[model samples]
Target: MSLTYTYFKMRKGFGRQPMFCMVKPEMVDNIMPDEAEQKKYCLRNPVNQESQAVLSQSQQEINTTRVVLTDTGINHLEGGWPKDIHFDDEETTSRYRRRIERDESYVDAIMHLTPKFEHYIDQNNAINMYDLFYKNMPSEDPVEKPIIRINNVFRDRQCRPTSSIGWTCEEDSKLVVSYCDKVFPINTPSRNTDLVGYLWNVELPSSPVDEFLPPVACWQVVCSPVSAPILLGGLEDGRVCIFDLRSGNSPQDISPEHIAHRDPVSALLYINSRLNNEFFSASTDGVCMWWDVRNISKPTEAMIMSVFSPIVNEYDLANAQPITTLQFDKAFPTRFLCGTDTGLVVNVNRKGKSHNEVMSAVFKAHYGPVKALHRNPSISKMFITCGDWRVNVWSDEIISTPIIPGQPQKYQINDVIWAPHRASSYMSVSADGRLRYWDFLRKYREPIVISRLSQHPLLKIKAHDNGQMIAVGDKKGVMYLVQLSDILVYSGNKDKPRMIQTYERETRREHLLETKIKEIRLKLTKTEDVGVEAPPIDEITEDFTSVESEYKRIVDEEVRNMGPGRTLSSSQLEKVKQEVRKR
Candidate 1:
């Protein structure tokens, strides 16, 4: 039939019935009206034979419709369902095709095109074959591996009665612990080691005469700078004890009559490096005494600290202040600092003939007693003080205010020490059990590292002269020996070291020149009162000869030990020649 005639016939007969109709079995359930009345009416009415035949023919044709699988369709099947079948937009279809192609695996099972009944049978056979292959596969041998077990020896060790907890590192890093009535040395090598090992220990002896009195506790201990085996300790009974590690005997207490102070001795310092036998001790008795180790029977000199008025030239001995700490300037050996319980610091000159004649300048430094004081190794004029929950840095020239103002209500600094090698870096332990390292040159307010320690607060701290180790003692008598890492001790930057060194040199020079000028002025003032006149030419010449003779005598005494000869030996002659060349 022509397509136009067929379309016209269908339009003419649209009101009566359709020539052909197609319906899928799946659509039969949905075509019935949902209303019960309508469904009943449609079911009750029956269709004519011609209409039924046309409907039946259309259903058969739909069932027998052929769907051919071409090579293109098979190739695209690997990329999943064809995109044009569902997606309408060309762009969206292309994106979906790309995604499916990227994700589809080539190893997926291949689907063969076949008759429906034959295909079903083949799928069942393939599944059975896979099961048989999986069940009969050969098994591989099981591998044997070693299991590791870790043990912590520190936690397992038994602790002593006196030492409830102990930790030790190694021999190279030595730490001294003071607890109860005994002092001991512990070697700590690393942070992880147990502090159970004690190389040696010494106990305080009881009073020979007075048994009722309590045994004195060792309040403070300091190692002798000159002798490795010598240690000086301050006792709670206002006496000083000297320990000789080499002797291996009990510590010897100084004579009762020559006791260092009337109250507890709080601090001890080796006064002079040149004279290792001399040390200075301060106590709560408001007195600081200089003692010679050779003759501990009596102090060589004693300075009673009292409130003094520079303007009125009056002294108040009634209200004496106990000295808390002492530090001497390296560049100015005669000049030393004394911090007192009254929050006052006194700058005194030790070169004076007597305590009464010594020159002193007093400053009210802190709100409470100055517990700790440390001088910067590089800067003689700068020193740090800790008292009343604050740390402040002061300059010798300006005593009215601190150069580095302390933060108010920030931290209760227990102890502070400057880095021996670095000019700007310093470390401090706070009451909160935090050890903080700060670089003042970079960020004055913030710290570089803050290490939290045990719950017990650190009471005393000391740094090794080499700047490699630091020792901290807590309230529980436990000692922590910390070895500074290379990065913490040394600066890798080149510019900072050079700049600090140059500044220190300049400051030293300026201080020396100022001291010389002061000496010259004093001499001039003395001469002014005498009204001395210039000497005669002949007298001047005579004075010059005497001065020359004095210089010759000094030179002769210095080289007096040399071999007896009118002229110097070969080595001496070479040194003399070199000196002459420099001149």
Candidate 2:
């Protein structure tokens, strides 16, 4: 019979227990013989005599400190080292040099001729295990043991690895809400250093401009998609800011667009559209305003997804309660899901349509507020998150009852994040500083509690694409990174899935001068032969020059169009000069 063992970390104030990794005997076998020896060394080398006696007594009870193998251990077998251990000259020399230099090597060697070195050692007579074992046993085939990588936070950032925290905005604009004023690539990992990313300050306009703000409350650190730089952030007062990250210098004095909510705008999600360069803004106002970033002066359309609560019979849309969380289905960009202070999750499409039930089924999913909702990045029909005190998964197909029907109301889920690089797996952070992982496909009896460190009320959690690592932050502004294997010996299979290779055109930035020259040479070689009469070199050069010049002209035109003052109309010189003066 095999046993499954796990190491769980418990933090203070957590009402739920999280399971850690499951280990089996086979997985234990992967542990290096040296590691097992070290464990024995640690246990035997008690600091005091009393502990030493306890360790001695415990060692005799177990035949082997070997791990048990089970089905769960099979999963830990991935990525282990190959068998047949071989060490190079320097490594082998370094390992054996100390013992070889000692003349005691021979006296110790003969001690192996006897039945027990342990017997001599117990009597305070000096002898080594290797010397004793070698005389009785012959050398066996060297087995390469698994190397375990432990999980720990490692950073190369020079900045106080945890300081420099705040919202991030773009560096190019002053309006703070100008079409170009937004941070494009949010949460980008550092390539050269361990410092992950930096933050930017957004300056707001001074006054409220009717459901909009001049710049004051309208100023926000716009968070948008990576590809298109559209802003989606609510301001300090009660307005939402929308900026097109792709905006060029179109002498168009376009007012930075804003959406007003009767209550302060709490949650915002920047949504992409199939329509050309169009985007929309959703606010706690219970109204989602759709705008074509091409012209942000006004909303192209607006839809109110919430109305008065039928049970309470009051206009809830314009009340003080605001939206707490928002999310978009990556697969279904046009459809959005929102959670409000009223414990309601509303799913709406771009065309202002909901499910057939109209004001869809509202569930009392949480006793308190729903902090976050995440739709699976790789899957469209499923979503999961934490609210009140429970973590739950939802699928459009299975909606009859709650998964954990009677989770206590005292549990408060502080944050939820989908694993960056995996599917059907997610992690949640709680008010108690607990980080737990849930595999939707597994039994919900208990989740894999990866780690638990004392943390403040967790305000945010972010994962990379692979789910192998995660970054979490708390209200006190402390951030922590959870790496899957800082030190783990992958004892599993090594054959990884072959990645699909797709054809990609090389960009100028990716092409070196030598590469370009070689490509041109290849083109010329294909066009001419040594035996045949070659085309006139002058004619060829002239044709190439003309093509190059035409290409440059096209590029110049495109660049000029991107300049702010280049698009001014001939009849609008006064307008242009006035705009210039204002700038």
Candidate 3:
């Protein structure tokens, strides 16, 4: 609303040009209202506000324990075993050695073992038993390299290769491992053997603290992020099972065999959820199932793993992708990633109506099946993939190529994982029996530390929550606990910013390349279309008057240049003459 005011003035000096006349009704006032507002009132008294958190609260005391480290040693004589024997005197030492060598028991043992040793020596002579396996493997750079020291080694008595290794939830002092025979066309004995998984504590290095029993050979195992005792396992027979240490050895809950995956289960993971009951499983049957532990008889949600192809115009069973690995980031609850046997990374949404709708994007991650997939804890935008002979680091914003497509190693990479504490550091185990540690902040181009850990391939690796230790399992049924140097375990100051910037720059470059590729594709399409059709043709025959006049003008100019005072070049004169003869 707007308003105007006016006033009236009395006449003054009417006889002449009076100033008092100006006081009469100088202005009029007008007002109009356009809009109005008022405070809203709620009639209900003390309306309740609902919250997502728990309503009940309780307090409890915590048990505290002190840790003490002790060192002890045993002293022994170097050469002589008997207390009466003295090895300082050469005469006495030689006399005792001669006496032992001449003993009847020692002579008999040597004669009996000589033939067995001769057989092994002859077999070795027939063929070179030991040869360099990791030929053409690049040596690690020596500057600022971290040392990997073996702290302890735990051997399995049953001689079963480790299939999966997982650390205790948010704790570094313990880990859980599942063992199974990885041989193809499984033998009757191997398949029928006792299926057992172990929960090991660092303090009890001699033996496992607990054991797990699955229905069949277990392929993958994972510890729940929210619960310490809750463990998830995916078996070779395509069943999902969970074990609780507080319970008995048998699985507390298991999926029904008929309703479960028709093929071997390949991947299993526990999602970050409030109830700690939700977990995901993937199988070679191209099916992914979501479950709630409270009611695991049937999956709460399920979907086929397939990508829509424009050529097919619909989802087809032939185009289904067999998921090899599954990774879920806690920060992104609605989305997850799947690695397929064809070397593709499928990014999918959980809350979708169908298989085609669930898939949002796909990345050509590797040439062979992806073995290990994990997102960096510090920078979620970057994720690492290990497969074939390569380990690639990818960015969420780029798809055409990986931001860090590392140099392909000589041997196949079995598993790779990021450090729990360091943002820019990661470790990878390969078939070459070597552990390669990389720190982007220290050396981004090449791995700084490379230590040979085993003669057999290291199958799986899992980091301790403290980041200083890692548990590596091999095909030989032995697990090596490695302690990493501080530089390889701790995050450098202000590392997140640098890592983010590096990824952003790489993403920008990829975007530019993508645009150029689109432009080139458009141009090729237009050119192909033009090429498909025949060139245009004129209906009417045209006269050659203009062409003839142009040729005459050129001949006249060439003749003038050949006058007595001037001469044309021999080549030019010959060309003019030739044209004249043709005309």
Candidate 4:
């Protein structure tokens, strides 16, 4: 039979045959059936009817196919499929050329046109607001430049090994370094050179003048602010040697009548900037002693820590906790902090009636001995503690937990100090010989800068008052002088500096108010069983609530004043306000 006759016969029988017959060549057609015809056929076929019944049992599946034509494709079709469109790839160009040579359509489609009114509308003439803004807006101006070049390195007298723990830069730019057998002062040169001439050198003092005097190591040293020439050195033999720079001679030992501590002095700090005559020292014996420059024989006030509570008179003489570091709150001259070798931080109040009553509170600050304690120069209530394997920031208002906690468990933190210029930034050096710079506001979990100095651990770090330079000293008797970049040293341009300052101030205020609320809540909960009505307590609670409300109002107003583009939406602002009120 002819092919046309066979194809016609197959088409006629295709609807009556099984669904599999649809795949046959004779049954397949270029054109699909209309929707009405398809629906009629589906209703008649038993298999199609079963599928419909199953679909009815559940929700019908909607199959959707959408085709979108790009402007390039539309233009190609409108411009008679030009060769420029095919130049995108060599293979595509060859394929298009072959198709055109053979007179075949590059794309196939069946058009069902609905007649409508045609108008001349240019599709490529649309305007973009971003383009207009880019053309009209002014560019941002640069910030003030910073000085980041390392000015000089002083590495003379390698034979005289220096201790990282005991060194300080004087106002005249002189460096006072303490070594094993003696304490010396070196005059820093203005230009870069290795020759550091000694201004003075004092032999460390020891008593009982024996052949074996333990080599008289100087553990720590500090200069008197009021008397710049006077230097105090903490010795290995539990004695503090006082040296007068003007004498240009050896240091004088404290008289036996004035000697106070019975163990090695690990830390020394001037109590107040105004009171140059008064200073505090912490020894391995766990006693923080406050001494006067005139009378070093006995401490006027002492804070003693013991393993037992309610320490008796005999306990003070027998048992003493080893104190590692000492720091005084700049804003509160009478209050000071002491870190102990047993991982405790004791907050001492010198104004207490008796020496035994000086310790106001004690906190378990670290898992190991607390190595250093540094108070934030800008914020009196906040301080940082470094020890064994962690570093943490604490607020005096709340001593139960740290505000910013550390996470490194492998490496011990040796030294930590707050940035002299920036309120929210600080730096720390770890036992792994890495120095890390942190910005609390930006990243809480990781440091902003991490630098590997050497294999030897960094034991001391100090920042200059000008905020441009920093000095890091390691265990190998090497000191590195680093200069900070402009962004890290100065608060950036006008807008950013103001925003950062405002953020820091507001955050501190919020934390203080929240601490107050916690105190009130604790008092309220604790007093429920007392059956005593305290009107003053109620009034204080009301005042705290009002203050908190005012704080939130101010924060909201500041956000709004920053302008609409910078501020949060009304709903978000309200949510923040509610959260603050709840706190």
Best by lDDT: 3
Query: Least accurate stretch of 10 residues (summed lDDT) in model 1?
Result: 205-214
Question: Pick by TM-score: which candidate is best?
Answer: 3
Candidate 1, residues 1-583: lDDT per residue as tens digits?
Answer: 5556433355665586647778666644556556876556645356555444453443333466688977653344333446455544668778776776665462232222346668799889868654556667886634432121111011112222112111123333234433432232125222222222222221111111111111355555666666555666666567776766566534654636455577667678776667768888887677777888877877787766764623212334455678878886668777778899888887877666544445456767898989788888866677888888878777676556566766753657777888887777788877776677777665667777777654766566667666766665555544555667655676545636664564455456656766888899899888878998657799999977876666565447547766466555578656654554454
User: Backbone collision count in every prediction?
Assistant: 8, 37, 6, 2
Question: Residue 97 lDDT in model 1?
Answer: 62
Q: How far off is residue 566 in model 1, in Å?
A: 99
Summing lDDT over every window of 10 consecutive residues in candidate 4, give the lowest-scoring window. Answer: 205-214
Cα shift from native, residue 350, model 1 (Å): 1.8
Q: State the local distance difference test value for candidate 1.
A: 0.61
- Judged by lDDT relative to the true structure, which candidate is superior, 3 or 4? 3
TM-score of every model versus the real structure: 0.50, 0.43, 0.64, 0.54
lDDT of 3 at 98: 95
- Expressed as tens digits, the lDDT of each residue in 124-225 for candidate 4 is 345453566566777874664433344444342443334433223455443455544222222522221222212221122111111111125666767666
Model 3 C-alpha lDDT versus the unseen true structure: 0.82
Please report, in order, the local distance difference test score of every candidate based on alpha carbons: 0.61, 0.48, 0.82, 0.65
Give the winner by TM-score: 2 or 4: 4
lDDT of 2 by residue, 168-281 (tens): 233432111211111222255222222122222212223311121123333223443343344444543445445443552111223333445444444555565554445555
Off by over 4 Å in 3: 1-145, 170-172, 183-192, 309-317, 353-357, 532-583
| Poorest lDDT segment (10 consecutive residues) of candidate 3 | 534-543
